[model samples]
Target: MKEELLATFSNHFEKPLIDEIMEEGRLMEVPAGETIMDIGQYIRSMPLLLSGAIKVLREDEEGDELLLYYLEQGETCSVTMACCMGQTKSEIRAIAETDSRLVMVPVQKMEEWMAKYKGWRNYVFESYQNRLNELLQTVDSIAFKNLDQRLVDYLKKKVEVTNDNQIRNTHQEIAYDLHTSRVVVSRLLKKLEKMKKLELHRNYIQIVNL
Candidate 1:
């Protein structure tokens, strides 16, 4: 299990430093639909996802949940920033989208390791930089891309499990992720269906090559 955590950080650091960090880490199990972190909750640890997926979301003024992104295996939780910055609260919620196992390192321990290990410090810096880049790209996409283009791009990027190229997500869920409205998504999906680009089952949409 510790080796798995080290593997997740291998892209950013030397294997030896990762091994040292993993030595201080412990595995945590989260059930599906569980909130790992809540708004206003201070995180004392950083989680490295070892298996399954989690959703990072925020609530709007209307109390609607808006998806910031999904973290899968090999990805570390964004809560690392809040913990490291000594933030008293977090606006984002990390919810387990599936039953997940995570390697958790206490914030204080991680800080200590950074002071002791130059490689580990570099890895954390690089990880934060990469995360910032991803956030900036997401913001740029939302600012410039239309709903149709965003939907198409999302579909292309998402994994579909059905053999028929079908995606099983509700309009409200899709709207939340795209920062749009369900009505708009419904209209766009209908248009695509009419053009024979896809077929809509009861709750799933199947995209087919023309």
Candidate 2:
């Protein structure tokens, strides 16, 4: 699993460094719907996702979860922020969306690896920069793009991977990704379905246009 996690960073670093990092890491399994990291709990290690997905969510005073971001396979958690700031607690909860395999490494071990391996350090730095760039892009899109535009753009990107006009997704899942309410996504999807642009099944939305 650690080998698979390191493969995601393969393009950013040398094979030797990736091997070393994996060698020093340990694997952990997280069950679906479980908290990988709870809000207000200290994160002593970083978890590199090897399989499955996780969601970063914020809880309100009333205990309602607001989706912040989603972590796919090959992505690492934001535990680095807590480690760097020496924070004793986190404000966000990392919840596993599916049964997940993670490559965990202690902060001290990560620091030691960075000191000993230049490639490893560079890879981590690049990962942070890439994540920051993604967040900035999301902010820009939300600020300037309307919901329809955003949804269309998202479908286009998904179509590239799916290689078909059809997509499998739910209104709730789309809302989570779009950082909007389910009612909003449902309303917009209804319009799209009426237009024959897609079909809404029991729990999945299928796009009909390429």
lDDT of 1 at 74: 68
lDDT of 2 by residue, 26-139 (tens): 788989778878878877788877777776776778666655556776676554554534746778788876678888777776677777877667757766776677667667
In terms of TM-score, how similar is model 1 to the real structure?
Answer: 0.81
TM-scores, one per candidate: 0.81, 0.74
True-structure lDDT of candidate 1: 0.73
Task: Estimate, for each residue in 171-198, the C-alpha lDDT of model 1 and write its tens digit.
Answer: 8878987778899999998887888877
The prediction achieving the highest lDDT against the true structure is: 1
* Steric collisions counted per model: 0, 0
lDDT minimum window of 10 residues, candidate 2: 78-87
lDDT of 1 at 133: 76
| Model 1: colliding residue pairs | none
In candidate 1, clashing pairs total 0
